[model samples]
Target: MDKINALGALGALAQESRLDVFRLLVKAGDNGLPAGEIAAHLNVRQNTMSTHLGILTRAGLIRRRREGRVIRYAADFNGMRGLIGFLMRDCCGGVPEIVRPLAEDFSNA
Candidate 1:
C-alpha cells in the first residue's frame, strides 16, 4: 500500500476498540464474522460495531460482504502484508537479526 493508505490503516488500528475488533476478526480467520456476532462477542452495541467496521473497511484493513441480511467482515490479508512490508522494508539498516524473532512469527501469520 501507499504511505497514505498505510497511515490510515495504522491510525484505525491505534484505537482500543478498533484494535480489539481487528484482532478478533483476525482470529476468526477467512470465514469472518457478522457484525451482530462481533458486537455480541465484544459486548459492543450494533451501531458502535458498525462504525468501527466501517472505519476499518474504509482504511482497507477489513473487507465487508453481504450474506442475506448479514454483513460479514474479514481482515484484508494483502493489506496487512503491505503494512508489515512497509514497516520492515528497510530491515533496521539491513540487519535481519534486529527483528528475526518477530519475522519468524510473522511467517506463520
Candidate 2:
C-alpha cells in the first residue's frame, strides 16, 4: 500500500470497536459473518456496527458482499498484506535474524 492507504488502514484500526471487528473478521476467515451476526458478536448495535464496517471498507481492510438481504463482511487479506508489506519494506536490512520472529509467526498462521 501507498502512504495514503497505509495511513487510512492504520486510522481505521486505531478505534477500539473497529479493531475488534477487524480481528473478529480475520478469525472468521473467508466465510466471514453477516452484519447482524457481527454486531451481535461484538455486542454492538446494528447501526453503529454498520458505521464501523463502512470505515473499514473504505480503508480496504474489509470487504462486504450481498447475500440476498444480508451483507457479509470479511477481512481483506490482500489489503492486510499490502499494509504489512509497506511497513516491512526494508525492515531487516538483509539481516535474516532481525525478522525471524515475524517469519515464525507467519509460519504458524
Candidate 3:
C-alpha cells in the first residue's frame, strides 16, 4: 500500500462508527454479514450505516457483495494486510527483537 492509500484507509477508520463496523466485519470472517444486520448489530441507523459502508469500500478497507436483494460486507483482508505492512515496513529500524513481540501477537491471533 502506498502512502496515499494507507492514509485513506486510516482516515476511513478514524471515525468511531466506521471503526466498529470494520472490526465487526473482520470478526464475522469470510461469511460476512448483510448491511441491515450489521446496522442492527451496531445499533446504527440503516441509512447511516450505508454511508459508512460506502466510505469503507472506497478506502479499500471493506468489500460489498450482493446476495439476492441484500448487500453483505466483509473486511478486505488483503487491504488490511497491506495497511499493516505499510505501518510496519520499518519496524524498530530493522531490529528484529523489537518487532518480534508484535509478530508473535499476530501469529497467536
Candidate 4:
C-alpha cells in the first residue's frame, strides 16, 4: 500500500471497536460474518457497528457483500498483505536475523 492508504488503514484500526471488528473478521476468514452477527458478537449496537464497518470498508481493510437482506464483511487479504509489505519494507535494514522471529511466528500461526 502507498503511504496514504497505509495511514488510513492504521487510523481505522486505532479505534478499539474497529480493531476488535477487524480482528474478528480476519479470524472469520473468507466466509465472513453478517452485520448483525458482528454487532452481536462485539456487544455493539447495529448502528454503531455499521459506522465502524463503513470506516473499515473505506480504509480498504474489509470488504462487504450482500446476501439476501444481510451484509457480510470479511478482511481484505490483499489489503492486509499490502500493509504488511509496506511496514516490513525496510526489514531491519536488510538484516534477515532481525525479522526471523516474526517469520517464525507467521510459520507457527
Candidate 5:
C-alpha cells in the first residue's frame, strides 16, 4: 500500500456508514451480504448504501460478486492486511514487543 492508496483506504473508512458497512461485512464473513440486506442492517437507504459500497470498492476495502439478481458484498481481507501491514511496517523498528500484542490479537481472533 503506497501513501496515496493507504490514504484512499483510510478516507473510505472515515465516514460513519462506510465504516459500519466494512465492519458489518467483516462480521458477515466471506459469504457476505446482499446490497439490500446490508442497507437494511445499517438503517440506510439502498441507494445511499450503494454509494458507500462504491467508495469502499474503489478503495479496495470491499469486493462484490453477482449473486443471481442481486450483488453480494464482502470485506477484502487481503486489502485490509495490506493496509495494516503498511501502517505497521515501520513500527517494528527496534521493538518486537510492540508488535507482539497485535500478532496475539490476530491469533486470538
Candidate 6:
C-alpha cells in the first residue's frame, strides 16, 4: 500500500472505538455481523456504532453491505494484509531473526 493510504488506515484505527470495532469484526470472521448485532455486542448505541463503522469503511479497513433492511459489516481482509505487508516490507534489514516472532504469530494464527 502507498504511504498515504497506510497512514489513513492507521489514523482511523488510532481511535479506541474504531479499533475495537475493527478487531471485533475481524474476530467475527468472513460472515461478519449486522449493524445492530455489532452495537449489541459492543454495548454501544446504534448511532455511535454507525459512526465507528463509517470511519472504518472510509479508511478501507472494513466493508458494509445491505442485507434486506440491515447493513452487515466485515473487515476488509485484503486491506489488513496490505497493512501487514507494509509493516514488514523491509523486515529485518538483512537479519531474518528480527522478524521470527512475527512469522510465528502469523503461523499460530
The alpha-carbon RMSD values of the candidates against the true structure, listed in the order shown, are 1.8, 1.5, 1.3, 1.4, 1.5, 1.6
Off by over 4 Å in 3: 107-109
Best by TM-score: 3
Q: Per-residue CA lDDT of candidate 3, range 8-108, in tens?
A: 99999999999999999999998899999999999999999999999999999999999999999999999999999999998899789989899899878
- Candidate 4 lDDT over 12-106, as tens digits, reads 99999999999999899999999999999999999999999999999999999999999999999998888988998888887889888887887
For 1-109, candidate 1 gives per-residue lDDT tens digits of 7789889999999999899999998899998999999999999999998899999999888998999998999888888888988888877786878778779988787
**Can you tell me which runs of candidate 1 are displaced by over 4 Å?**
97-99, 107-109
TM-score of each: 0.90, 0.92, 0.94, 0.92, 0.93, 0.90
Task: Give one digit per residue, the lDDT tens place, for model 2 in 4-108.
Answer: 999999999999999999999999999999999999999999999999999999999999999999999999999999998898877879578887788688768
Clashes of each: 0, 0, 0, 0, 0, 0
Q: Give the C-alpha miss distance for residue 28 in model 5, angstroms.
A: 0.7
Q: In angstroms, how far off is 92's CA in candidate 5?
A: 3.8
- List the candidate 5 regions with Cα displacement exceeding 4 Å: 106-109
**Candidate 1 TM-score, C-alpha based:** 0.90
* Clashing residue pairs for model 3: none
Better of 2 and 3 by TM-score: 3
Output the TM-score of candidate 4. Answer: 0.92
Clashing pairs in 6: none
Query: Cα lDDT of all candidates, in order?
Result: 0.90, 0.95, 0.95, 0.94, 0.94, 0.90
List ranges where model 2 is wrong by over 4 Å: 106-109
Q: Residue by residue across 1-109, what tens digits does model 5's lDDT show?
A: 9999999999999999999999999999899999999999999998899999999999999999997899999999999989988888897683889898987887688
lDDT of candidate model 2 versus the reference:
0.95
